[model samples]
Structures are given as structure tokens and as C-alpha cells.
Target: MTNEKVDVVIVGAGASGSVYASVLAKAGKKVVLLESGPDWQLTDLISSEIWGRRVKPAGAPILLEGKNPMAYAAQGGWGVGGAALHYYANFPRLLPTDFRMKSEHGRGHDWPIAYEDVAPFYDKVAREIGVSGDARAEEKWRPAGEAYPMPPMKTFRNGNIWLKAFEASGIPMVPAPVGMNSVEFKGRPACLYDGWCHVGCPIGALANPQVTYLGEARKAGAEVRAWSTVTRVLTNPAGTRVTGVEYYDDKHQKQTQEASVVLLAAWSAQNPRLLLNSATDKHPKGLGNASGLVGHFMMSHHVASTWAMFDEDVQNHMGTIAVQYMSYERYPKKSHDGAFGSSFVTAGFAVKTTDLANSRADLYGPELADYMKRAARNLAGIKTFGEEQPNVENRVELASEKDEFGMPLGRLIHSFDSDAVALWNANFEEGLNVARASGAKEAWSARGTMPTSHLLGGTIMGTSAANSVVNSYGQSHELPNLWVAGPGIFPTEGASNPTFTIFALSQRGAERMASQWGTLTN
Candidate 1:
């Protein structure tokens, strides 16, 4: 095996990994970022919804294909930028009460670090990534922080409809906090309100890794080696620290790289997979698997959508992927009963012409044509996202089956408990009610099946080694030099999009690594 040395080795050049690489490299540390996919550029992001499907691999849409398919509740993105390349840019922060979910609501475990502790980092990430929102509008849930770097995207037709419905229901609707550019912050141009973002933004208006951390990291002299899949992390004989990583390059040739520290930012599934695959004599089960919690406690938010046929056209498919509003002011509170509050957003409704045409396939001739004709108009829709409690049994484990690489594929055996199911049903009904209040001709609620975009808490963070894999600062309790920098470290899945939180945690981990750089031996 060939060996090369670096100060830090980061696996998975995704959202979290990109930020960590940028931060550490900017601090003048030598870093190598290994990604399983090819290097993609903003220009390469196709603008068609159907064509964007090519960006992610088949079978495993959101995650990289391994031994077993990596299943996400929504859908995931793969490749050099990881899932961030396909993110909707919804950048809401975790509500303050989200930190103490178990204490306040007797649900999931509380975070060792509170919203207050990470508030500054959140602000830093928002500014660095260029958030365009009105923090004042989110006063009830957002922590006290500096103003948004840019103004909010203009309200769209569907947003206006949803606003009225929320007003009628006594639920306030505020501009959704998005990472897309509103006024050209960070050298990116403002959004053109093209409504084609769900397909991936070709323009740099959306703050995907290509425009944010990846660019900065590359400019800072860090090397991102794409199509280099890390199979296992190697540690010293004592199993006290990481030595380097073994990977398969684009040519399928095995190679090794040494580093003083190794950071696993490969999302919830693969992070634990690498650790488990790296079993050695010193750590028989796996590296840092002393607690055997590496692949436990998988959490994903429950998402539900409500569609309405409004009397007036509410063209929703007209702005950023997610452009309208969010309601979390009274979330997770008593008003919602035992059901937790959900973060709801109303985007310019997608025109149902395509859906209608697809649905007409079973029907014949004139009836199909008539249905398609009527579906051409804008149909307003609102989606509600609710947090799921992290359950240890809902986990990612190595399947008995192996992939082409001879590595055990990640198999997700997740089941939502009764409480989570109840919360989902309640949120769906709430969304439908809002649609009705908006004076829609008809409203339909769609429950989530295998839909998930935000995956969190597999190798969760906690105060003790007995209960968690990582500590509050993201350092692995079982392996000190090994760190996790992603939503995987979250102890609880808060009712917000996790991109911002991932960046905050990455910044925190990077800072700690920088502070302790001297202690790390190369």
C-alpha cells in the first residue's frame, strides 16, 4: 500500500466535511479531503428536475451506494459535494427548547450543548455561507444573533396564500430562512426566482458546497481527492489514536494515507460503517466501537405535504427550491398537545401538470387529456417537517450481504415508534387544515413513507462514553483523535433543516482541533 502523510484526513467532502476542511486549511493546517464521487461544478448542476436524477446514483439516491443501499427518509445527494449539492437551502436554526427536548417534553435525549452554546457558531456559519433571511421575524425561535447577511427572498404567490391561511389560523408565518442569496452576499449573485431549484441550482445563488466551503477550502490549498472511497481507518497498535485511512481510488487501486487526526463527516450511515470496518486486534469489534453505539440511534425527521387547488393561481414553483415561510414559534409547546410542533413552509405550489399526466397513464384517451389540461394551473402546497426522537433500535448496521467492493453495505432498519407516527399524522392534519382555511377547492395530505432529507444522530454526541459515541465537542469518546462533524453528532433531531446546524458543529469541531493542534502527532 502506498502511504502519504497530512495533518488531517477528512472523509466525505460533503456539507460538514467541506466546512471543516475550509476552516482547518484556512488556519494553515495541511488537510486532505477524500470524496467517493467526482468533482462537480456549479455549471455541471443540471436545471431539469428529471435530469438532476443523474447527479445521484440509482437505488441509493441520497447517499453513496455501498454494500447495502443507504436508505434516507427523504432523498439524499451523493458525489463530491455530498447531499449539500442537492439541498433546498432551508437554513433554519434549532429552536432553543430543542436542546432540552427530554427535559421539557419527555421525548428524546437533550443535547449536552445548548442552543446558546452554539449560537455564535450558528451566526458565523450563516454569515460565512450567506443566509438571506429576516431573523427578526423568527424572534420567538431564533437565538439572539446578528442580522442576516442578506435580505429575505421576496414572497411568492403561494407564500401569500399560505400567509393568509396562517393568519386565519392564528399561526404566524414568517419568511423562511434560506441559504440562497437575496442581495449578492459573498460574491454570489442574487436569486433569479426561477423556481427550478429543487432540480439543483446551476447558478451560484444557492450556497451549495461548490459555492461555499468547497471553493474556500480549495483556495486555501487543501486537496479534495474525489472518486476516492475510504474503506477503513487505520489506528496505531494501541488503538488510542488514528494513524491514517485506506481507500480505493478511481482506478480501484487500494491506497493509504497517513494523518495525525481523522475526521469522519460521511453522513450518518457511512461514518459508523468506516469505524466498524476498521476492526483491529487492539479494538476487536471496530475502531471506537467500545460502546457499540456507533451505528445506533438513527434519527430522521417526518415530513408531510398538503396540496391545494386554490381559486386563484398561487404559482409556487417560481423561486428558490424552498422560498416561502416557516412556523415554529409555538412548536413543541402545549398548544399542540402531546404532538410536537412542526416547522411548516409554503412554497409556490408545483404545477400539477406533470403529476396529472403521470396519473393519467392508467386512464384512457379523453379523460386523461381532460385531467392533464386542468392540472396545468398552479396548485399551492405546504409541507410540514417534524422532528423524530432518536431511537437506538432505528439503526444502520452491516448487512450479511456485501457490495462489489467486498465491504459490508449499510442496511437501515428503521421504524417510527407510535409517538413519531402520531406526530406525523397530527402534522399532516394540521397542514390540511391550513389548506382548507386558505379557501382551496380541494386539499390532499400526503404522508411520508421513505422520504427524508435531513438524517441525524447515528453516532450521537452525549456527555458520557457509556451512552454516546462522540462527546459534546464531536470528539469520539472511544477514540480521542477521531472526530465527527455532521448531523450524526446530534443527540436530538430538532424541527429544522439540519444544514445550518451541521455547519455550526463543524466550525466548533474545527476550532477545537485547531486549539489542540500541538497535541496531535503526525
Candidate 2:
């Protein structure tokens, strides 16, 4: 059934959509954000790992088929706040080189805009939401920007173990730039450091959208329609512009939201899935697939995780469940002889049901129990992140299988190229060395490629429709009224987590969208 038309209908209430909802509403545009999951309020954020799974995608899972399948459900969000509700709040910025990957290295795709274009929004958003970091100490890794509003976040007991190794390896590390408060800012409390970040942070210190942008959106008169699953982006007869969207209500009834502007702001897979599923007689391939590249070039960071055991109690469970120390010595895309991409250091991972059991794949009976007993006090680990090249063959396509709503499920096909493999291998060996240098009585790592989450590509933003679905500002090239956002628009997957960049890009586009209200609606 048709609903009353509004100025804008944004799909997804996650990181990117929340930013748009917040800014556009403040700019006086009538905004409605549709989420496919329940309306998760702060009180709904339970502090239990098992209950925390509720925040993950509860509907149909993305069908994965590739050399290394992604951990989509583990990383994706289902409810109101989206994945931001359960993310660890690790807020590292994309290196300036990230934007110009192809321009500088003759590999990957160059962003239509540069890091400079995103810097202002990054600075503004970080301050507004409360980011804690030591930019000066991050050295050449961090680009020019205002210092973080808060200082570095809390450190765990295992931090010393990794710090010593970092020093010895000549890859000195500093406190990570994090979204959780180092001290109270914007009235949000400091992190409890209980390491319950895997579950949702109920105290409102972690900068999840519920505690930040969505709150702003509500105060600014934006309406968040939770349990509204957007299935297709409706286009005008000529497919020149998007008229609105078609979705399923919580009761599984069909509903339509007509808006002057329609945005596919969900994460990578869902955005392209919606678009490809919305094909019309005028645009047979997809609404934004005039170039036939709507869901191509899907990318995920190449990651490898390593763990170790210190002689005595290291108390690895006491701090933020995020990467505690940061180093970018290997951050240059071609820093090494054989490696073709950049890699970074992520150490002192929170030990929750961890030193992580992946290393002991063979042990289960008493061996696993004994390891856990020691891990309670003396376990620590390190993980290394490397950029994954955006290969055309790695992509998301509509699978033959359909969900309960009769929508074609998205099937992903992805594999690391030789360049990404070389990069991951070089850094993975060093990660093992770093663990050994920590004076660990025992050190080991999980075999195979680690399950990754910070996803990118699929509906990449570029210079034109011939090569990309959206432009520099995330405006769709084929349909100007149709916009896309989040990590899905990234041309390259830099090693750092994507939430920080997602906010910055959405903020940048939101301002432009607000400024062009007359041009768009008219």
C-alpha cells in the first residue's frame, strides 16, 4: 500500500543512515529511516554475549561462496542501531593514501575525492561523537586533522606485553584512536572497560548510533521506522530518478514509502541486493546498474590473528575489547619487496572466551579446558590487518534461492588476489615473531585466513557510471535522486575498521544533500 510521501526515505538505521537522518532532519528535510529489525533502545542493549547475538542479523543470511567466506552475521547488525550497537568502537581513520590507492600505486581504484575532502567531516564527527586518540603519537599514520576531543582510551594489563614486543621489533605502538570515551565528553560516560563490548554497551559510552546520531535524528524530527524491510528501490517510468521504495512491514505486509529522495544506505551486500532486485523494464540490469557493475568488485580486508601465552597472569580480559596498540610501519602499500598492499599492527585483543580457541583447533576434551584455565590470567594475542585489492571477480550476485519474502538471496564470491596474499603472508609471519618476542612461553596462530568483517565495495563510488554505481558524494550516477553510503561505496578496503570512515563519508554527503534540497526535490 502507498504511504504518504516525505522528503526523504533512507534505508537502514545503521552507522551511515543514522548520520544522514541526523543531518538532513536538522536541515529541515522530512526524513524517515527504515530498519529491517526491531527498534532497539538503550535498555534493549543487554550485557550478555549470548543475548548480544540478537543484535546480529536475525533474518535471512547472506549466501557466501568463495575461497574465504566472510563472517557477515558476526559483523552485521539487525536492529535499530545496526552493527554499531555491537561493534567494538575501534575508530581508526583510513590513511590518506587509502583514497588515492590507484593514483599512487597504479593498483586498485582511485576515489573521486581525496582524504582531504573527508578530513573536515572526520574532524567534526569525531568531536561531536567523542573520539579519544593521540594523533601526535600515531605519527605519519594519521593525516592532518584536529586532535581528538578526548585522550587515548583505557589500556588493559596485557597491553604491556605487546608494548614491549612492539618496542623490541622497532614497530613502536601507541594508544588506538577509539570512539568510546577516554573521559566523559558530550555527556557520555567513560568506558567501563569491562570488555563486554562483544555484547552491546548499555552504559551509552561506546558511541553507538542509539547514543549518538540516531538520538540527534530523533531530536531533529526524523522518523525511524524500525521493522520495515526495504526490498526494492522504486524508480520513475524512465528510471531516470527514484520515486520511493517498496518494503515489508513487521507483520510481513507489503508497504511503500514514497519520498522525493530515496537512499540505499545499508551495508555493502544489502544495498546492491536491493538495487539489483529493483530492476524495471526501463533498466533491465538494475536501477543503478546501467554500467552492469552494481554488485561487482566486492572486497574485504585480508586479516590474520595470532595469540600467545605469557608465563604469569597477564589479565588480558580487563580492557576495551579492541585493538589496544597501533603501528603502521608496514602501512605503505609496497613497503616490502614482494608485498603489493599495506598492513598494520593490531595487538592486545581482548581475551573474552579467548586467547581465542581457534589456535587450539585440535584440542577439545581436557586440553581445551586446561588452556582456558591458563587463559584466564596469562593469555594475550595480536592480529595483523592488510589491504585487500578490489578484484572484479570478487562480487555479490543475486542467488537463485529466495527468502520468505520471495526476494532473491545475495550470493557472494570472493577470494584474495596474489597481491593481497603476498601482503597477508609477509605480515602474518611477523605477527608470529612479535608473539615470540613477547617472551611468551607458548605462541601460535589460527590457521587459514581469519574471518573478516569491515566490508567494502559492491556499489563503489567513482568518477562515473561507466565504472561505478555512485559518485564522489555517494550520489548514484545513473539516478541522481538515488544515493548510496557506508563501506559499500569504498573503492578500496584499507586495513583499518570502516565505521569511522563510514561516518565521515555520510556526514560529507549529508551536507551536500541538504544544500541541494531545492535542486533535488524540484
Q: Highest TM-score: give the candidate number.
A: 2
Q: For each candidate, how many residue pairs have backbone atoms clashing (under 3 Å)?
A: 12, 0
> What lDDT tens digits, residue by residue, belong to model 2 across residues 426-469?
87788888888889998876666556657789999989988888
For each candidate, what is the lDDT? Answer: 0.77, 0.85
- 1-522, model 1: which lDDT tens digit per residue? 776799889999999999989989999989999988778877777777677766664322223332212355325666778888877888888878888878887877888888888999989998798998889888876667888888888877767877777788777888888888888776788888876665567778888888889899999989999888888999888778898899988888899989888999888878888888889999887877788888888877767777777667565456666647887754654446666544444444333244445423455688877755554554667777776677778777776667656778877766666666677777777788888888888877764342455678778898888878888878888777888889889988777888888888888889888888877664
TM-score of each: 0.93, 0.98
The CA root-mean-square deviation of candidate 1, after full C-alpha superposition on the true structure, stands at 3.0
Clashing pairs in 2: none
Candidate 2: RMSD to truth? 1.3
